[model samples]
Target: MFQDKGALISLPAADIAKVRVPGSIFPAQELLALELREDLKAAVRLIKDICEDHGVDSLVVARPEMFTNGPTTAWLHNRIGGIEDHICISDGRTVRVVPGMTNHAFFMRLGVEKNFERFVKLQKRCPELIRGLASQINSAFTFPADASIPTVILQPAEGLMNLDPAFLPFCLVRHSVQATFDQIALSGKIDLTENFSRCSRLIYVPLSEIALQSEGFCRYIAREIAAAFFDPTVGVILALPTAETAESDMKAGIETLVEALRGIPGGIPSVASHRIVLASQECPESFLFQGSRRVELVLHNSLDAWLHPPEYYGRFDHIVVAASRATDTRELYVEYIDHLLGRRPEFYWLEHLALHPNDTGLIAAW
Candidate 1:
């Protein structure tokens, strides 16, 4: 296994036994309060165990993106008590706050720009994901109280409709199917023009758009994408790096992708077994071979050329394209792929599921 200096102590599956907390203890008004209470207890226990085992006195907990100015901080403080002073909450940036301290005080004490510089330095030495996940397993217990944390929020330039052209062919296919069904109803005759037996799913990742984002954000997005459709059955096509893509960005993207794959429940072994098609000009050696596990990467020069003979013919049931915009070139590429596939793409609603709103809009625009 590839190891990072800041890696968290691995939480074994066998060790995570379910604790059945009685529902009667929780208020009847809140349906999930009991479950939430149990989960929090488990998280606190895990944190305490890890801290004791490492002989660590104070720790910084990275705030998850979801808990924006929520009651998580108060809830955690209630459970952990005076130790809240020892626990600092970070928003994956320069902003770090203790339990009672307001966001304004923290920023006023440490200037925004200076804090960012310090954060950059800290990031260079340690992986943010490790630090973040180590303290809080799934969700961060702390929430940003009053300060608006400046973080990059990547958004697709175009609406969902114009994002991927691969769905165009699928739309046409569906229209045809509907028309055929209408004809059959009118004439009372069955006409099977197309066979809807074998279907394939295409997961198109817009690498160019996500390349420049922070490594933490990249990992988050990669994990979300993988969780949604990282199966052997799905056909994934990651768009090639654009001219504006930086080498560091590509490296971060690749590393985060691998991390996301391995970070999932089953780890590298489960990911390595999946037959994923990575459509790119060249495959990076680091991505293909991570420690002892080898991932079989299928590379192609251009989307146009790759779809010429359609490697996995009549095998795609879903086509997922992760792009910021449907550029003319990208549209053409998707169109070509759709043409080759010769099937209607089933539209799966995936808006705002993978990428969430962030405060760093200006940075992302730049």
Candidate 2:
């Protein structure tokens, strides 16, 4: 809507009909209202028509591989003054779009060399920009990193311990404050409420508390996590480590504990014959764990580790967390930023960090 390339582009009616806009600072109702506004509708129609003429027939915008720079997408976004989110669907296709600019670019356009006085002057003149940006900040939680795939995130702060046994296979909320452990009692062999009491009190527990937690508790939680992953029907396991501990410490802890899980008598190894694949930032490694020679290891410290397709890495039917509570407070903020960038959460929720990669001076999370 913001651009006028004069090239007609018709979108697949089906794809346009399926486009979902999540509730951000604005609620779903509010976003719908805005979408229905005369101006926006007109803009969208024009944009759609332009896209259709250029053979952009579907809402599916062609994209480069995840993490690989898309020259065309970037060029279009820069000219159009907007950001576009591709919603991927099954069959390895992207058929949905969330498009908007959060005014981040405006401030960024001022350049690092700009003075604080200049920012103050600019802010006074751009009242609408300020208001719009504020709205964007408040609407963060509505949309999550595209749920097009059956991907689930085990946040570091709240591992599989926070989830009920029944919902282990289903998707979960981003924040644990929402209805996580509300219905704790279940008629299962293990009393989930009884075992992980300390872990479930808050979204995140300190490292000291984690250390004090019983091995039985860890093992029990681990067992349940393993059970969720190794369902006999499941093909491969994607183990994503979300712990906020030190890089070395969290990596070592996860690798060791997972190995232990495999060795646990009657645990995952006994239940399923799926391979466990881990993404690391370093080269791939291999080792025998509990007599199962079905683990594929690779280095992928980037978030892309979790975002990439299962088949690209190998056989994988489900993704589970090797998640632990983040130990570092800074990691919490970094985690939020990652969520903001990947999922486009409301901005104000993370505005405190100034979106500065190096807000801590010494510890920049770029």
Candidate 3:
């Protein structure tokens, strides 16, 4: 069916009969063969149409790795008459089969100075030019880099007070119309100006009222918080349910968080052994405590040091604090845990400043 009218064609009769047998069990194989044949026909038609439109009499096939002896190249030469006369093949060290054109002429046309000898000498100095060109062409289209910034979650003042001192420096307070950084600073109980100078350590992120109302936005924030647990630069993340957050939304957020955490090297088992704390105001229905052994679930109104006692909190490697009103008690819980664990000296920022001062400037700009 692919051949022109009155054109002579060769066929392997046995092979054709085997594949074209009626009610064959190998339906998938037959379908694939048909699809491949149709695709080749389409490709040939497109190429012929392009050539006809441009009024081209010959085709120049330039390939960095094509071999004259290769069956595919030989078949292509046979299928397209006079294609062999215009073929150009390069094997890193040398270019061959230029036909009417000389190596020196080709090199000159390609912007190489002087002659082919100069091109050869340049290739010797930069071997990557010959090898990487094909790979560069192959990878011209790719997925864009992940440019989205981490979502910032703003906790209540009481919640912020309870945050682990180790994580305090990395915390970013969101300054919405509902609550501003200046208003929080005036409280006096929490020294927002001294500790968080120039909005450096504890920065204030201004979020629009629309963003705060978005459930999808809230879920994205939850995923970011969950992702932070695995990030070396990020310390403990304190997340509390806001008034707008529904139980379903909270469950969905937790599910996303759990999925992200489970992607760690040793999976959930390793995460359970880590010094991680998950504190929430209300228990989401999606949180599964089934297989987790080292995870301790503590239900308390306030994570006050005196009420819980040191030994009880000290026993577990990972703790999940669930309170009746988690938003109200989150800070106290984090504060209590921070006090119990004792703040370890963090020099990540100092190290970053020393190593990548420009990157730090970029971060500050962001």
Q: How do the predictions measure up, each by TM-score?
A: 0.22, 0.21, 0.17
Cα-based lDDT for every prediction:
0.28, 0.26, 0.27
Q: How are the candidates ranked when ordered by lDDT, highest leading?
A: 1, 3, 2
Error of 1 at 149 (Å): 29
lDDT of 3 by residue, 139-168 (tens): 011111232112111111111112222111
- Highest TM-score: give the candidate number: 1
Q: Which has the greatest lDDT?
A: 1
lDDT of 2: 0.26
- State the lDDT of candidate 2 residue by residue for 1-366, as single tens digits: 212222111222322344454321111122323323221233234334444455442232322222224664455455433223222221111122223322211111111112222444434454443333312210111112231112122121111111111111111112331222221122123332332222311111112112212233234444444554534322222333333221333234334334433433443322211122222222112211112223322221122232222332333112222222223433444354444233322211111222322122112111
lDDT of 1 by residue, 170-221 (tens): 0011223344224323443221112111113333443432232323334434
What lDDT is reached at residue 140 by model 3? 11
Can you tell me which runs of candidate 1 are displaced by over 4 Å? 1-199, 209-232, 240-253, 259-270, 282-359, 363-366
Q: Model 1, 315: alpha-carbon shift in Å?
A: 16
Candidate 2: where is the Cα deviation over 4 Å?
Answer: 1-131, 134-238, 242-278, 281-366
Candidate 2: worst 10 consecutive residues by lDDT? Answer: 104-113
